[model samples]
Target: MKGPLFYAKILLFGEYGIIKDSKGLAIPYNTYQGALKKSKNLSEVSKKSNENLKKYFDYLVGLETTLVTFRLVEFKKDIEEGMYFDSSIPQGYGVGSSGALVASIYDKYADDKITVLENLTRDKLLKLKQIFSKMESFFHGKSSGLDPLNSYLSLPILINSKDNLEATGIPSQKEGKGAVFLLDSEIIGETEPMVTIFMNKMKNEGFRKMIDEDFAKYTDACIDDFLHGNMKSLFGNVKHLSKVVLDNFKPMIPTAFHKVWQKGIDSNDYYLKLCGSGGGGYILGFTENFEKTKKILKDYKLELVYRF
Candidate 1:
């Protein structure tokens, strides 16, 4: 038997800035998705997935909460019967690989689960985010829960702050030269370590000031600009945000891409920023000329998200 599918997600704007109440935007990435399935004979890859499911099942069983409950007995039976998460979303690529799995499991086993078909109110959305944060924290030591929330609803989510968020609409994609894309770093990013670095930086008054004045400012403006279908303004703000990241969040950036990241801003071809927690994953990119940027970034792989 196969469970329902859950798509991957792209945090186009938020990244680390969301942790400190900066505005952020995320959209569902339909190119990659996941679902639960069972087989009588498990392949090596399936076996590994099954093993992880067993561990996650144990964690769920121990959770004490009123938010939601799982069908543990059925879940365990399925696990014993070679149930595993069959997925196409790449892990450690900052595209919500585990978040998709979390959404799928919640869809299948959680009692009183919130379906996407319902008229999702703000309170319901926040509740789901809170539950997802608790559920997804098993994978990352700390989770904002927005990843799974985006995957679960399969809608563009806008984060106004820690306590405010909503499902929002993005302007329809156009076949224009400008685009938002993903640049593969070809290196895995570990969330816990990167978050540790960010947390450490937050302690310094100077760093905190930059985040408040520069990072969050540009990030909020970029989100506002993009949502309003203002590409020109969006690019300008994204450039400023890129510079802020390069100057302050160096540890979160993969060392190899440092020059290129700066070069994107310097040459004005494309601006690259973190996709998730940075360190090494898919770096989010925005360019007014996709063809030119693609040629300049010829050695690396680029996945298009939206065209402007």
Candidate 2:
């Protein structure tokens, strides 16, 4: 049986900055999504997914927590019968592929599961984040859990900080000259290693200060501007944020795009920033004029996410 579809998510603002308590905004990307289903004759890809689920089942069973529990009996039965997550959300692209899978499994098997219909209070939302943090950690090695949280709720989430995030209503997309788009890098990114690099960079006092001052400031401003529909301020702040990421988070930016990233900032046609963890996935882009930007970057595959 097929279950409900869980959508991919875009961390519009606050990529690495969120780890340091910077304000962040995430929105559901409906272009790609995932759901659970079973097949008697497992295809090669389905077979791989089923085998992965088996391992995930073991992890959940062994997890010691009162926060949430799953119906292991039924889950195991499904796993044995060739259940797999059929999804189009590309992994390592930073668009929450695993997050959708985690959400789907939790939706179907978790006892006392939090439903999207309920009044999701601040405490309840945090609880969901905490529970998701635990469950999704199996995939990311370490997870802030925002990915799964966004996928599960199918709502835009605004992060005031690590402890203070909530389902937020973003201004409806206006058909205008401005837009946000995704530029596919066509390379797989490993979250664990990228994270390790960031953690190691944190040990440097200089990096820490820059993150606290420059990164956090621009990130918060961008989030505020985005929510308020302040296109002018949003573009300015995003330009700063994009520059900061380019200058400092160089390692995270895939090597091939260094020239391309800088070219945008130079030309003012578009500004590019990390879509997720960088190092290869989707690079987030912003342009004041989509028509011009479209012609400017015709060599690339540009996917429209939101119109401003």
Candidate 3:
């Protein structure tokens, strides 16, 4: 048995800032995805995935909640029958790998699960977020639940603030020179440790102030600019946002990419920011000219995300 596909997601803006009630924008990234499938004969990879699912199933059974309930009996039966997640979404890349898994499980087993076709009122969206938060917390030590929310809906989500988000339309992609892209950091990131560092940093009043004032302001601006198709303003805000991340969120930035991150801000070729938690994984890049940015960073791998 195989279920439908669940795609990956990218948080275009508001990475850590969102933890502090800042606005964020997340869009579905269809380039990579995953789905649940069952096989008559399990291969090594599938066997490993199935084993992991067994553990996850055990975890879910212990979760205390009133939001959504899973069919643990059926889910366990399926796992024993070779049910496993067949996916291409890269784990530890901050591209919502576990999120897709959580989404697939909920889609297949949750009682009265919210379908993407529903009207998706504010209350429903929040409920889904709460449910996803609990499910995904099995992976991340703590979660905002946006990743699975984006994957489940397969639509752009505009986060106004904590507890205030809705599916919203983004500006149509255009074949313009300006673009949003991902740069492969070539290093895997663990979300739990990175989040721990951020939490520890939060003990500082200065860090808290920076997040509330600088980081959130630029993130909100970038989201507004992108939605409004205001490229001129978007680039300007992205520059500031990139600089702020580089200067304050230094620990999250991989040591190897510090110079490259600065180079983009210095040359105006592109602006680099954390894609997700950002100890490694893929770093999000913004450039006015994709070709020129590609030329400048020829040695590194680049993937185009959205054109503006």
Candidate 4:
């Protein structure tokens, strides 16, 4: 059976700060997507995927009477018939693998939680977040619901504050020497433990202050400069953001890339940041000159996202 497809998402800016109402931006990353499908033979992972989805659907079904409603019977029947996610998105890669699955399940099963065809207003978005938080909590111990929301909407979501979000327009990429790219670590990173470490780090008043004063400032500036097409300001803020990640997010960054990450900061060639939780997986990079950054970091692969 064909089901609605949900794309992967990138939390371009914000990250941890969004939890505290810091400005944020997330964009749909179309490189990976997922859809529901039935198979004749289930691989071990597929079987596990289906089994996990059943319990998630049951949880959603249990919540239906109090919140939204859906076709639980059909959904359950579909699950019994080998329904599984056919997806290119990598799990534990910080690319919204679970988020896309959650989005697809809500689309196919939820009765009136949200409608893709309808205009998504602030109220609708909030309701969708509420439903998605419960659904996605199956993956992350706690979820902000931004990942599924971005994948489901397939739109650039701007987080103005904790409760405020809307579709936003990013500047068109210009043909230029500079580019934003993703460098794959070639290892999957689990989110929950990384987040646990972050929470533990938050207990330090000093670390908390850095997040509030330093990280938030640069992240907001990066989002603002990027969306407004202010390339000069974008690069300046990216430099600071790169340094912040290097200083505080050391544990999350893969060990091998630590030198590369620092080299960029010192040389002003390319700035790197955690793509997601960052123990491994993809690392996001910003360069004032792609040719220069590439030449400096020639050993690693890069996937360009935007140009300027």
Q: How does each model score on TM-score? A: 0.99, 0.99, 0.99, 0.95
Please report, in order, the local distance difference test score of every candidate based on alpha carbons: 0.93, 0.93, 0.94, 0.86
**Best model per lDDT:** 3
Per-residue lDDT tens digits for candidate 3, residues 101-181, read: 999999999999999887999999999999999999999989999999999999999999889998999989888898899
Which residue pairs show collisions in model 2? Answer: 252-279
Residue 238, model 2, lDDT = 87
Model 1 bad stretches (over 4 Å):
none
What's the lDDT for candidate 3?
Answer: 0.94
For model 3 the local lDDT of residue 260 reads: 97
Compared to the true structure, candidate 1 yields what TM-score?
0.99
**Candidate 2, 1-308: lDDT as tens digits:** 88899999999999988888888999999999999999999999999999999999999989988999889999999999889999999999999999999999889999999999999998889999999999999998999999999999999999898889889999998889999999988899988899999999999999999999999999989989889888898889988988999999999999989999999999889999999898888999999999999998899889999998
Q: Is candidate 3 or candidate 4 better by lDDT?
A: 3
Model 2 segments more than 4 A misplaced: none
**Candidate 1 lDDT over residue span 31-127, tens digit each:** 9999999999999999999999999999998888899989999999999999999999999989999999999888888999988899999899999
Clashes of each: 1, 1, 0, 2
